[model samples]
Target: MDKKAAKILMSTFWGGGGWKSVSTPFSGEDFEYAKSQGVMFDPLTITHDEIVQRLHEIHQDDTLQERVVTAFLHSLSTKKVHLRSALSSWALTSQLPLHTYLERRAVHANTSACGDCNFLRLQSDQEYVDADLNVLNFERIKWGGVRHGWLLYCLMDLELLYKDTDAISEVTPEDQAILVSLLEAAQTGDPKDSARSLEKRWKGLFPSSKQERDALLEIWAAAGLLVPTDKPRRGKGGSGDFIFVATWQGDDGYNTDAALRYFAPYLPEIL
Candidate 1:
């Protein structure tokens, strides 16, 4: 498994990119997430140059592309770690596994995880269909090394009906509406009202109105996005325990469970 390399790859993949978790690890754990791989990097400094360097190293042997993608998707589905960009700083540390997955999938051009990844392929079934792009462009899909781990949840939800990975992103408005309602329900669980909550917490992302705040958090929570973890900001007592979210949509229990499983597979694997 190249445990050390995987740890590094995990860290760089999340921290070096801009992706992190929104939920706090524990009540006082300031960070929303931590890298099991331990690849330390600042998301702010990550650039395409760095990504290209990492990619060159990753593509050396493309056999393990599917494995690497699986590992990453497992992480995404479970929320152990979320990346900021697809450039994959994690690959820097995880040489063997990364190479293994890439080497295997490099030749499988029909659905190569190592190829032009316009969308995520987090499926047990290997049939990939790169069809329409609703919310983002292929290149624009990832920036600052991060984006919402929406595809994982989409795949899981769609898999209930045995759908293909190609059309998973097309999550219907009815389903999204249902998720939004779930987010609204969860948010109301907090003591604060939407107005106060918006002012006190989510000012940066949706500082305009309560509706905007609700909408923003709703999308994140409902879609099961990963906030950041190695964030540099400080909070109460000048400590790094408070994870200030611009907004959070919701994190359905399924994604939360999956996230923990991915990062700490030993727990479920052992049990």
Candidate 2:
């Protein structure tokens, strides 16, 4: 491994920000400093083949974490899953507590019980079954070989979703309008298009508060509806032009000026 890559990984691991916080692990200055030290590596410079090669190399270790990471990376790079659907599912399942079903059972029984007792007491009510299914789905993602970055991304998206719309059950007409407007804007294929620019253009359609609009933009990016522009020079500079990768280190802000492109291939289906 390159020493610079190792250094970057170490920094990312020890860094601070998380799904609950607005800040990122590394600030803009950190990227600048890394560049000055000749240690910054642009993710855009890496090709799919190179990524697969690296994954192959990492798979040699055969460790559980390595295997999980490799699988997650492969799925992401290959676009194996429908991002919009996956995000929606995550948002829905994440809202409920992991032990919601168990708690409901305990409440009904009106007694403290061991794990086996709780399992035996499980009811067949539709609501309980739905809650149990939600918990199961959440657990699968939480402990079933998914990457932490993706998990964090989902959590952050859910937080923003609640903050902006206050519900995850369904997409309202207004939400559909906003999504359509975004799709139309992206269809223009303008290289200068950024979240700030779009927010300005659709000011009437978005929330009045700047912070709320920013939250919505962040949620869109996390949902993979909006992605960093493919313009090579844009992401090359370690400045304010980067996408949210849900990683601890790196740019995490909405980056209103960072050009974004519509990437939801399933938008029409959803709309």
Candidate 3:
């Protein structure tokens, strides 16, 4: 390999931030040994999506799989699987993990042109919402594959999400109210709330039989905000609950600028 190729492969093995990582126990040693053998690929300039596309372009050739995996292994260890194996994995699977799903997106464009873009306007599937959450398990594995930079892209988006500066700020009415109050509390650095306060606030949300609002609140509380900082203190009138109030987007001492920025890009006029 040339100097550039060598440098890229070395960096890829450690996941760019620098260090070997195996997503699963089964991935151990094999990819590492391949690195030692000088196998690597520059996933930056070319993406995993392109790699799959190339496989289709050449798959008709009887020898194509062997040839490509040989090339890939030479750049990064192929282990035992050939290119056909990897490419087939892509073609057959209807979906991938959210990480791979986003990174290997087939096309690049807004909704108007591509049939698959989903307009990226952000919608939900029945029983499921495309909630782009944080990398819940990032610390467990430093990185997963050569497709590392795309993961970086995801992290950057999340950082910007927390920065509260995205233009497409769409929160449900209830979440809006909750986020408003929590943000206000954040400003005061007073991060406590009455026990079961969320339960009370969200009670009317499900008019019918709601199995357990407390349980749902627990999940949100765990994610961040709506948290309980300390035990409730008994007050003057006898023991009343100590409560931390929530502030809203339009309320005093809240920052909605970031939300404006995030939601703006998705707006019809700006988009």
Top candidate when judged by lDDT against the true structure: 2
Q: Candidate 2: which pairs clash? A: none
TM-score leaderboard ranking: 2, 1, 3
Query: In order, what is each prediction's RMSD in angstroms?
Result: 18.6, 22.0, 21.3
At residue 68, give the lDDT of candidate 1. Answer: 33
Cα lDDT of model 1 by residue, 69-181, tens digit:
34333332222222212213222222323222333444344323443221222221222233222112111212211222223223212221122122222223343333333
Best by TM-score: 2
Give the whole-model CA lDDT for all candidates, comma-separated: 0.29, 0.33, 0.28
lDDT of 1 at 133: 22
lDDT leaderboard ranking: 2, 1, 3
In the range 1-271, model 2's lDDT, one tens digit per residue, is 1345324433543345522222332346655555454333222233222322333343344342222222222323222221222342232223223332233444334212322223332112212111111222222222221221232223322332223211223334454455456445544445444556654554565433443334334444543445554444332333252233222111222223322222232235543
Report the poorest 10 consecutive residues by lDDT, candidate 1: 133-142
> Which portions of model 2 miss their true places by more than 4 Å?
1-170, 235-271
